[model samples]
Target chain A: MAGLSDLRAGFDPATVKEDFTLLRNPHHDHPLVYLDSAASSQRPDSVLAAMDDYYCRSHANVHRGVYRLAEEATSLYEGARQKIGDFIGAPDPGREIIFTKNVTEALNLVAQSWGRANLRPGDAIVLTEIEHHANLVPWLMLASEIGFEIRYLRLGEDGELDLSRLEETVEGAKLVGVTMCSNVLGTLVPVSQIAQAAHAAGAVVVADGAQYVPHLPTDVSSLGADLMAFTGHKMLGPTGIGVLWGKAEILDAMPPFLGGGEMIKDVRLDGFIPNDLPWKFEAGTPPIAEAIGLGAAVDYLSGLGMAAIREHEITLLSYAMKKLEADHGDALVIHGPSRPERRGGVLSMQLDGVHAHDLSQVLDSRGVCVRAGHHCAKPLMRCLGLAATARASFYIYNDESDIDALSDALGEARSFFA
Target chain B: MPGLEDLYREIILDHYRNPRNAKELESPPALRAEGYNPLCGDEVVITLLVDEGRIQDIGIGGQGCSISRSSASLMTVSVKGKTLEEASAAIRSFKAMMSIHESSLAPAASQTETPTAAELAKMGELAALQGVVKFPVRIKCAVLAWNTLSECMAKATDAQP
Candidate 1:
């Protein structure tokens, strides 16, 4: 089998790992084998330096000051917006991209702004069972207030979304919310297909790209989503910055989400006019340094190439699955699509006779950082009959050696329990 | 940097492997309470029959990590057949023992101060759980059942009036 280390010299993780400072520093006895990138990726030196440089040179409140430093700060922040929108092939980068705290806030922005303005009592919205609480909770919160009905797209036994009744389920629904990738199972959903059906049924589609944008090549138009939400922290950028990309016409029709200084054009004693397309959604002084850091992150990923990153992850995933199955045999159960090509680089593992938390504790002792929990998707966990799962997710910095370490740790844990 | 040996003592593992009172009591005759560690999805359900002023029997249910499972098992054995006041005292002492390090950091203050020799003696087998404080995240797992039992006691007390 072609492992990550054996990949062509042009794209090498060993060289890529050097760019991240955290990987070089070992806080534990063992070297850090970070396999939790899906939670939050480690920032490269370029991204870190970009944020630091911005603070040192130009630290000013954006869009308000007429000073030179303020102009520079505003320029950097808006430049980031342009690049990020272009990253996902947004039609009009200036008008379509809205910055929020994180993906949760981004999703809430869509549901609160669009759903509140358009939806009424007895109107139906469709959400899949595998959606993160970020996607599900916002719609549920709106439905409660508006007295609308929320329908679910059930998950299949094979850990894929059951779209057999896609036409019937989304028939007259006003909106459809779905995740582009399962955070727990790593199963990639065909959003384009879902969007087609949702559009045919006169429903607008909102895709949660939190787990997908970091690991795959994304084109907003090709995705066919009216609006998409994704975070910077999970894609090699800092926390506190997220992107909400929407079609120009759709965003133009929506009302402002949060009311504050930047979101308004002119204020009166009684009422006020909302700002333009993107700023109307961005209420407060945004995360200036973090946005610059995210722009640097996009630059870093572009240099390395997203396609190469995906290929590297596929090599790692294929090797990991084979090695785990060969070494552990019936002792371990891997969730999601058996084929690596069909999924991202996330592996949620369950060891026989061992709880996910115990397994993660054991892995931690060996410096293998894996997430053990419902992964913010309790509905999906309940569907799988699992309280929790030990998830090991790969990114550009991971390789086959990390997989070996994980396998070796599993052996020790199994034997220790025995 | 305590090793796994500190967290996974043999006695704790034994209780985890063979949990005591891993069944639910009848609801009409028993008071029930549930606790959940939302971070890790570790849940512990407590059902106990409180008659007169004493706990007649106790039951443990739900699923969790080894630390939680064993802690629940140890809690049931520690409180069973004890008077209501005595069980409540055990709860206080156990919680005090859990937060011993936090209290020691302060200038010898409040009810949750470091346990005395007598209180330590009261902890008995439950003292094995002090290792949990080392891994702060797992502390919730160790205390889930204790907190649930506290709620159950509150329910039992409310029924008296």
Candidate 2:
């Protein structure tokens, strides 16, 4: 964990442990050890308090208001954009950060906007085989509407995207959309190379960063992504707030997604002109509270440092993989990248003689909470030739003991059915 | 060895190791139904030989968890040769004994009398699985096969008119 310790910028893991309000189980008598961060990250108390403080004192609708409360709220909202810009490596102008409801909407915005404007009939869009439905469905819909061809970048034997074929796939393609880190397989893709290659071919690169942002420091400029989408909930922030970082020129040209308040500069009987840059895309009562919450979440993550978070996660992930392979090798099969740094914290596995659901039941009884399902990554599940898998993911608050609990619970599950 | 006793009570092992009347028959006279638990991926296919509103025979097919498979075996042995109303009454009694409520949980079953162990065993070694309900996930596993029986009967009645 030395690498992780260094990345945390000296945020001592032992001393910096804060109270995560969501970890407290209201229903269970036992202290809940949550291992499902991929599903939703639990919020620390500081983040909750920030939102509470905002609502209590300075909560007001941002932009277009003349009063002091509105001015302060607007500043906070814009400040959040800058914070996100710094957090995600979008420092050119925080105005590049266009807030949406979630990653689903951000991806959809790009699909409906950029896709509609740039793509021509007979052009092709290249997507990796493991794209989450959020990334896949939008492009698929746009392709069908415009008669653009859709192609997939195949997975290698290890389920990682075939880097050998990425260059060829991006050649002459209109756009390339891929996940920075696969939600199910946890394979970290080489976005920089893909982005450079796509640019060489006059193609745009869009990265789905929902799984990547929480585990690593993602810089939009360094990533070379023309567009990227990520959500707050997955990063221990509030839901209903997502960010889409795109080059300013791309956003200026793309069509609007939602209509009404704040998105337009002037309304006319004949036509309404759109607002400038980021506001042009934001429409109809943006998620003010959630934006404030996300700002607070950014502060929390920054204090701990992304490198520290990444390092700790890699340590925990390696520990878990080793434990699963050593202890449950006969009865369980682990899936994902072999190297810890090449993936996020998601671990998918199958237990012998026990269905994922039944195993989860026994685990739940023992006070272990894990997800057992398709994980909304149906395409990836199909690629793996599995209907579902039992998953155990980790975040900052977890340690070696959580892995022990998972291993013990897995043994109990096997015994219960053996 | 933990003994099959840990998972499949002696009665469940008996049913699973030797399923009774485990065969398919002619289709038109037989009422067929499928039961599925979407969350767990357990599925059951049941066919009943109903003769003049009486279950002349009952059998099932499909693969699932241990509790579900064992429950199917017991259900086949228990419901054969019983009148429609009698089988219905037993199912009701069985569901009530399961001690569940429709208001809170989705797709609730509603027969009100809690059947005793003797009554469940009369339904055959199905009583072996009462222990499964204690494990919430297994409750659905144990009930998947029984739910198919109720569907088969219900469809059989609707077809009669």
Candidate 3:
């Protein structure tokens, strides 16, 4: 609710950008204007140092070894769980936060473990047209096996979720899977309202927060979601680390997602007893170093403050939208909700006479890194009637100058193609 | 913008803006196959009419980037009246030109060179696409039409007997 000027007096983009080494890209003569944070954020020096400190000082497998090094490693890993839990306001850090390779795997864990145990044939699973394949495909795979009907919440002409038919969509659904924010459209869905609706229909709600948690302040309790999936890489942390936070009772009741060393209590000839709530879902060795890095990333974000980050991004988005509209006008068509408050800083633009690929190529020549494609949301692209879009997403490190560079490059691309 | 100029050559842009044979073929003798680049959502459908081992007519339909659309347009002209074997050979040569090892294979064939009359007649304007090898990601775009052509040819052969 606080404005950027009101939140943090010392919050500055130039200073904040210094923390990230990749922003100081030395390969190109032109400074790298990275606009692809929605794909994966660039890590900060503190996160890198944290991972380095772990591998250098304390390197051992967790939960199995009793040695001092192993004990230290376990503490660091568990400590990250507490930090991330606090960051997102999870109910119980130890019991609810399960680590996986990425959000895709985390969603798969929910579909395979929780969905399989809870759903039945003829049960319906509600989803949205804007969900990334990560959140859509797993449920589809489960639907094929369980014979559940998949109902879709359509995207409105305004690019936001059309909840006009919310009651009918979630009427007989066993679960409602949705993205908190669309990665392509940048439309922030009303998750709390949707969760309330789903609960009224006697269906649990699972949210894909891969694009939301990084940019905004997240509280699982506030959102009223039973389960949430997010990745570390999109939040200034390393890859190969994702989190699935769920209600402890729900996680405890679900079957294990995979059979492995750490996710078990005891193994016999006939069967194996699963471990506790969260550990039962985390199979094999976890991403120890990446977790440490994520913890450091959390620390960095907490230092800057999430509210400040959100405020900064909103300001940047307003500035960007105004600049783009005033400068390019009819030559560029920006997708999603026109109001900055209604969307995140992700701008999916269609330049006149320039294809997304060609636009991206031209932008790259100018050292502007914008993502161009379906962005793993092909169904959403189909809904928009576009084969692809050239997306430029903003983050904590980005500023007005980067957007200016992108605009200039895009102008060049359009004229070049013409 | 040296690299950019090479990738988006004037000839390539010409083919893209004014795509030749950009229509659907009547079905009786036309064999068609669809090709898609999942990464970019670029889709192309190639329709070929092969009669007695010769490609009598070729048509390309669908939408994509300049690289893909232009490639499809250029492909129709290059293989329209050629024998099926000659079309196949042209595809092979185009693929070879777009290969990552193209520099090692043909070190002297940079974009700066003006093609001899004989060489230009042999390879046609597709040689302009040779610059695509420098950009690895766009190579798939350059090859989508050729791949669809191969698929159409295979389907035509299968339809026989």
Q: Work out the TM-score per prediction.
A: 0.97, 0.83, 0.95
TM-score of chain B of each: 0.89, 0.80, 0.84
CAPRI quality band, candidate 1? high
Ranking by lDDT: 1, 3, 2
Q: Which tens-of-lDDT digit does each residue in A1-418 have in candidate 1?
A: 3443546524778778899999988958899999999999999999999999999999899999999999999999999999998888898999999999999999999998899999999999999999999999998888889999999999986678899999999999999999999999999998999999999999999999999999888899789899999999999999999999999899999999999999999999999999998999988889999999999999998888888888787888999999999999999999998889889889999999889988999889999999999999998999898999999999988888899999999998998777
What DockQ values do the models have?
Answer: 0.80, 0.19, 0.67
Q: Which residue pairs show collisions in model 2? A: A4-A311, A7-A307, A7-A308, A8-A308
Report the TM-score of candidate 2, chain A only.
0.95
Best by lDDT: 1
What is the C-alpha lDDT profile of model 2 across A1-418, one tens digit per residue? 2335434435543343447755654425555767888888888787788788888988888996899998888888888888878888786555689999999999999988888888999998899888888999998888888899988887886657887877778888989998998878888888888888889999988999999998898778788889999999988899889999998887777888788888999999999999988988999878887888898899888888887788888888888888988998868888888888778888888898676766776777667888887777777776787766788888877777778889998998887666
What's the candidate order when arranged by decreasing DockQ? 1, 3, 2
Q: In model 1, what are the clashing residue pairs, if there are any? A: none
Off by over 4 Å in 3: A1-10, B100-121
List ranges where model 2 is wrong by over 4 Å: A1-9, A12-14, A24-27, A144-146, B1-161
Question: lDDT by residue for model 1 over B29-112, one digit each (tens)?
Answer: 889898999999988888999999899999999999999999999999999999989998888777767773334555556644
What's the CA error at residue B27 for candidate 2, in Å? 11
Off by over 4 Å in 1: A1-6, B100-118
Backbone steric clashes in candidate 3, count: 0
**Higher-ranked by lDDT: 2 or 3:** 3
Best by TM-score: 1
Residue A358 lDDT (model 3): 95
